[model samples]
Target: MTEALATLSRAYRMRVYPTRDQARLLAQLVGASRHVWNWSLAKRTSAYRERGERLNWVSLSREFTEYRRDPERPWLATLPREPFNQVLRDQERAFANFFAKRAAYPRFERRGGRASMRFTFDQRRQQVRDTGGRWATVDLPSLGSLKLRRTEALNGRLRSITLSRDSAGRWHGAITADGISRPAIHVPELDAVGLDAGLRDLLVIADGHGTRRVPAPKALASKQARLRRYQRQQSRQIAAQMRAQGLDPTKPCPKGVRLGSSNRRRKTQQQIGRLHAQVADLRRDALHQASAAVVREAQVIGIEDLAVKAMSRGMGRKAFRRSVADAALGELRRQLTYKAGWRGRTLVAVNRFYPSSKTCGACGAIHAALKLKERRWACPACGTEHDRDENAARNLRTEALRLIAASSPATPRSGESDARGEAAAAVGRTGPAGLSTSANREPTVAGSGAKADRRQRQSRPRKTRTDRVAVGSG
Candidate 1:
């Protein structure tokens, strides 16, 4: 029987050039959206304060409609209903995230940051087509047809198109689409590997055959001097601009006094923004290339989940902030995760506290006194000399294989051959289940005894793909 394909959602972002009239309209839409968000938040907070009742999207939306009809607010009536409605939906999502503890309370969005407005309409009515020229246009609800620089053809079902203005004063559009491609099926034996990510060597990989190392691009480091020069110049320009307007440079801007924007200041700010964007682009490109290579080679891959947030804290010289920031470890892991999921592969992040470096892979002996600078060490138990990163990669592979073995229903019983054990390990490697450990043993799930769990696994039928465990350190 053929396997059913899983559909994935994808988004494409591109630079957009708007005419003078369209630019005005876009600005109006952004302003209207911000107003709607602020107004809805105020109403919700007031209701909660007075009646101890929370106002949901439906209530806020109803109030929004009522407010639009008021003669005092004629500008609200001029704004497109769809984008304005999207503002309410965005706020609702924000509140949901806050309540769920995924994010902090939704603050009112200020105008000067990145300005964006998402166009909303029924999918059946939306039209996105290429003009065969250098441009393409998408039909928005109230904005009509908007042209953009066409590079690739827009495929799949259109979900939404968002127009945004960056801090550098450039406008761009992003189109999100769904049901583009099917998830890939991975071959276990050829596609199972382990990774060790660090500053010295960006990634150390260990497949069944051997190991390979990928060096860090150090994009940020390369451009830091240039960026620092630009930043210093921008700071001087800001202070001078503030002084010209008779405002205190060190103190905050007065309550209602808005500073005038000069061409030179704007140009300087844009230069800084461009440089920042260049470094970001380079870093992102490098990560994508590295991640794509890893995913293409391995279906079941294990990596360390480093505590980047904690590591970035403090001002110590040994803290290695520049290395940590330049490494972009978190971003690398994030790319590997979603890409793996999209391709029907498994990407496991080992527990942060797992001492892959301290534990000897050959003898399973823990060396508590091993320091970071000691790149190589000799194990006392087995008299084996181990390269720090290489040993860690091998241990990660072994631990990952063990995890795969424990999760499999077909794990070899006592007296089983090593070859069959390896095959049994291969069978379970492509599943979502991941391995993590404090020592060498597998962490028990729930409260079931190991014997009872083994018996249960032997008795029960195989589960569907959706029922399988998610890829993460349990």
Candidate 2:
């Protein structure tokens, strides 16, 4: 499909500078939204537990509106209606996801968590106005046109605006738009590749070109000592402050602790938060660069559908396990999945239970006795020594090729036969016949509109910013 014709939903997030009063208003809106969510969740839980009745979004919203209007909670009326309504809609979505078995039960929003609120636009009443030259203003309900640091032309039809605050007290605006123009596609050199993710190596890729391993940065591991020290100091300060206030040091801080003025405890906590953010940023940067590199090189990318949560479970090799979790394997997979789609590439996920590690690549021998520590071993049947990760990567490639061949009947016979034989050999090494990899049974993760005022917007020449990247770098 052509770039303009193909429909796509995209989000652009930029740092927004709200005035002092506007910032206070935004904080109030976020607090009110959190209150509404928690109240709705409590109501839903009560109804389900008491009478086995279900409370849907609409009913909860209607009831909550009346509650807000009541004299008991007159302060709710001070908040904007749009953000409050959006909160209810989000709560409804949470409940729907829970019912569909995609997520756990909806939980109450905490006070000190990441604060955010989304506002839908009614073009007739309010919309984002571009005040010319890389500057635009979003007309929030209570807080008038908040200035956003725009770096690109907002061409598409605006859908919603989400305002969020990071842990470091910086506010950002994420604008969702539809029918954004996509760039032209680039044909890559390699047709297919298979990746095996692990703690030592973030990913091991086996492709037609060769095998490549991306080492994990271990960001959190590298900064753990510093983080622990800051955390310990923060705890000590908080306990001492609590005791100075005539409160028990061992017990929880008295209510309204956070409502107090700035102190050493708060500053220390901020330091710890900044460290955590730094680690997260490093990990994200590494994943994005690696995933983009892989996606740019291969058209058909195959990755194991790992149950990272299951892998992280248990107390075996705590440090190693923690490193695996910190590697953010699932996040990498998620990034690859979406990036592949955007770049017009195919991403195939191998079955999680598939023994990519245990099977032999050279002779297709199944090393049933292979332990986690056995990084290299000789295939008992074929007598070929193999590196465990390299073998798994090769097996993943073989299985992926077999899957592609089975799906596409017109593929070359020699290539198909090679993949089939290698795959069958790997399966045969496992046991007997009928033990083929379940490529066909890949688990499908239970995973818009708008035209424009014609050619006027498209006819405008694209602006190339010399000083900055695109607004939506992701």
Candidate 3:
């Protein structure tokens, strides 16, 4: 028998350049889509308010045909019908998310915010035309061909392509396709690593032997001065606009006043947008390099289930908050998740409150008195010295491997060999399905009797490839 390859959905974002005519048409499509989304939202809201009836996409889409044919809004018929219909579908999805309690209510989309349109047609036709060297074109219906910079070869079935304009005034296309790839299978006894995400160091990776620290980049530090200068110019320009209107500069822009945009103000905003894009690019570069390195080195990856949002609210220092934002821990974890799966590696997430820093890996004793300020501490029980970050990584690695060993059906039974027992003990665990306390114990989990303890272990959930145990304490 042969193993079958798995197919997964993937999206590739490519830089797109449109000609003068195409740009105008693309802009019109974006505006039309925005208007459709807003109008549909209003219609749905009014229907539910007046008649107490829910307006689904099917009825709304049907009414849209008549609305487009109406003389009052004939401009809606100028663009391709696909985007207007897609906007309604997108809203329907948003409503579904809201109903499922995954998102808030759908709101009207504003102009000049997120200009994008999707083309979801048949994939049997080659919508993507390769121009040979470093150039290609995306063939969207009615919009014509938009030039594309082909950085990599397009693969699989092209399902849909979304064209979007960024804040930097650049056009791009997000191509979603379905592709087949070989699944990753893990080998037994490979290296397992624990990762600690921190602002000081980008990542602290620990395996059985030692720890390695990857330094976090100071994101766009060099461009900060330029960014600040442009920001000041914008502020001064805004106040000058208010003063020109014979209104108090300190007060807000009045209800009907138009603080018209100047060439300088527009240019300043563009520069600011470019600077932000550069900073994001730099951050992604560092994250990708570090994550790729880790995925290549270790087979079993472990990390703490950090609550980044909660940490920020309680954080006192301004510098700490800024650093947390720049660290991009969430982005790094997302990359690790997909990349690890693609490479057939195992990922284990430790419970956030699992005292990785306070627990002594030497004797499995958690140092309850350990403080946040103490970068290094001596374990009171084992009398061993420990570096805070290093100890945390080591402890994380221990717990991760312990989970792997315990849940694994292949782990040697108690009667197998003395060598297997010693091996399990070396990693601070016992035989397969045995309680993880110093290796030689019979089952000291929380149960009083032997059968009760066995039942507890049996009922305990076994973790999958990316699953993390919710248990925090020893």
Number of the top TM-score candidate: 3
At residue 171, what lDDT does model 3 achieve? 91
lDDT of 1 at 130: 79
Candidate 3 lDDT trough over 10 residues, lowest sum = 439-448
**Model 2 agreement with the true structure over 1-474: per-residue lDDT tens digits:** 675578677888888999999999988887888888888889989999999988987898789779889888888987778887888888788888999999998888899974999999896775788788878898877899899989787767789999999998899999999887666777444567888776567678898866888876767446645666786786678677777777887776666775243477678878876776665566568778888998777766766654334433442345434434333555566676556544545555567567888888877777889987788888999888888888888887777666554454223245434443333223212111101222222322100001111222354342210110011100
The estimated TM-scores of all candidates read 0.43, 0.41, 0.44
Per-residue accuracy of model 3 over 214-289 as CA lDDT, tens digit each: 8767664455445556767887898887888787977667787788778988988888778656655665688799
Q: Global CA lDDT of candidate 3, please? A: 0.68
Q: Write the per-residue lDDT of candidate 1 for residues 295-327, one digit (tens) a residue.
A: 777656776654434344443333533334423
Ranked by TM-score, top first: 3, 1, 2
Candidate lDDT scores, in order, read 0.66, 0.67, 0.68
TM-score: the better of candidates 1 and 3? 3
- Best candidate, lDDT-wise? 3
Per-candidate Cα RMSD to the true structure, in Å, reads 26.5, 27.7, 26.1
Worst 10 residues of 2 by lDDT: 465-474
Scanning candidate 1 in windows of ten residues, the lowest lDDT window is 430-439
| Candidate 2 Cα outliers beyond 4 Å, as residue runs | 1-5, 188-474
For every model shown, the clashing-pair count is 0, 0, 1
